[model samples]
Target: MTFAGSLNPSFYQSLWQDCDSIYMQHQSNCLTLQDNYQVNVNLLLLAIWLDSHHQLLDSSNWQQLQQILLQWEQKLLLPYRKLRRLSKAALEQAEYQQMLDVELMLERKSQAKILRNLKSMALNEVSSTEPESNIGRYLTLFNLDSQDYPNLGQ
Candidate 1:
């Protein structure tokens, strides 16, 4: 089980409160070419959760996780994301909108795969509320708000 094993998707979803608005305000263009917003945010949330639960993967595993994320981005997420980004321009076309919905589903499946990977790699149960020391680095990489989530006990 992952750090979030005891939790539900909504818990992770809530970490980035009003996500669409937060995303609009967020300026980092990290992963601009390969990532869709959904995959990126979900990965960030997993990193945060793992760190918070003192279950962050070691470097090798982290690298493996990254590779999987990259594969998903390259193979599944990016194309759909690109299409969705063009949705506004194709607004009057119903088929275009349907395509977005299908792509969104595919994107969500990709997220599920990421979550499964994290779950499979989880090696320890959370024993404390304090996060792992290296979590700050990842937070910086993703431009995530460290304060957004209350400590696990809270």
Candidate 2:
């Protein structure tokens, strides 16, 4: 179905910021997903946002979204995130903060790209027969359990 209008990127940014707060509150689990599983937290938040809006991506759309996020994660976010983490010990406080600001800027760019793609796509409406949550579907691709993570949408 067609979107009525373009989604505001700030809305997604707000969702991510709220989820990021939760991640900070529950750092260990988030760190595990980040460090061990390499889960992209922003993508998870996007899944939750889409589910909240009753939007469903067909398999092809879902795969394309994954590919987009994977490109951002692999080529940009991950390396910068790793550098940020590593720099915490090696760099001075001010310099590390600058790195963090830059990382956040990159994250905003990534989110905008995702939202732009979403705006251009034809998404399916969530059907009664599809009882699974979007976040659950997304996590399933990585063999993850929704119960293992904080509930951000509900």
Candidate 3:
């Protein structure tokens, strides 16, 4: 059997139709759940939203979406009060650790100064000489000697 003579839609029209179908399906499911005592407004809205969008999203294999939305709603609504308490606890712990780090760094700096002083004292007891009889290699890499060069000490 041959199927023929159906109109061809533009790319955007086809895309819109697919989107509309998903939305309709989600709305239908959400409305059905409204009659049940177990579904809240938040849950119904979340379900409808997820039903339409989850196919285009990723990788909890789509299983955790409901739990994730619930958690997100909780976080959004009561975050400052709850999270502030948590952050205050974390800050105190961090401050104690920071004090320990500061103490350790001060000790290390003191030790480093003692070691550097000992090193300078040892160097003061030794003698060194400049190389007076050797010639060094020269290069023409940048034609540096082609003109006057700036003083390197700067």
For every model shown, what is its TM-score relative to the native structure?
0.54, 0.75, 0.21
TM-score of 1: 0.54
Predicted model with the maximum lDDT? 2
Cα lDDT tens digits, model 2, 45-81, are 6676677668776555656777888876788888888
What would the per-residue lDDT of candidate 1 be over residues 54-148, giving only the tens digit for each residue?
Answer: 56455455556667877767786777677677776857678777887887677567566766765555445545654543334344344544454
Report lDDT (CA) for all predictions: 0.53, 0.70, 0.31
Model 2: how far residue 5 lies from native, Å: 5.9
Clash numbers, per candidate: 0, 0, 0
Candidate 1: stretches off by over 4 Å: 1-39, 52-54, 93-97, 122-154
For model 1, the run of ten residues with the poorest summed lDDT: 30-39
Q: Which parts of model 3 have CA positions greater than 4 angstroms off?
A: 1-21, 34-60, 75-154
Error of 1 at 24 (Å): 12
Q: Which ten residues in a row have the lowest lDDT in candidate 2?
A: 4-13
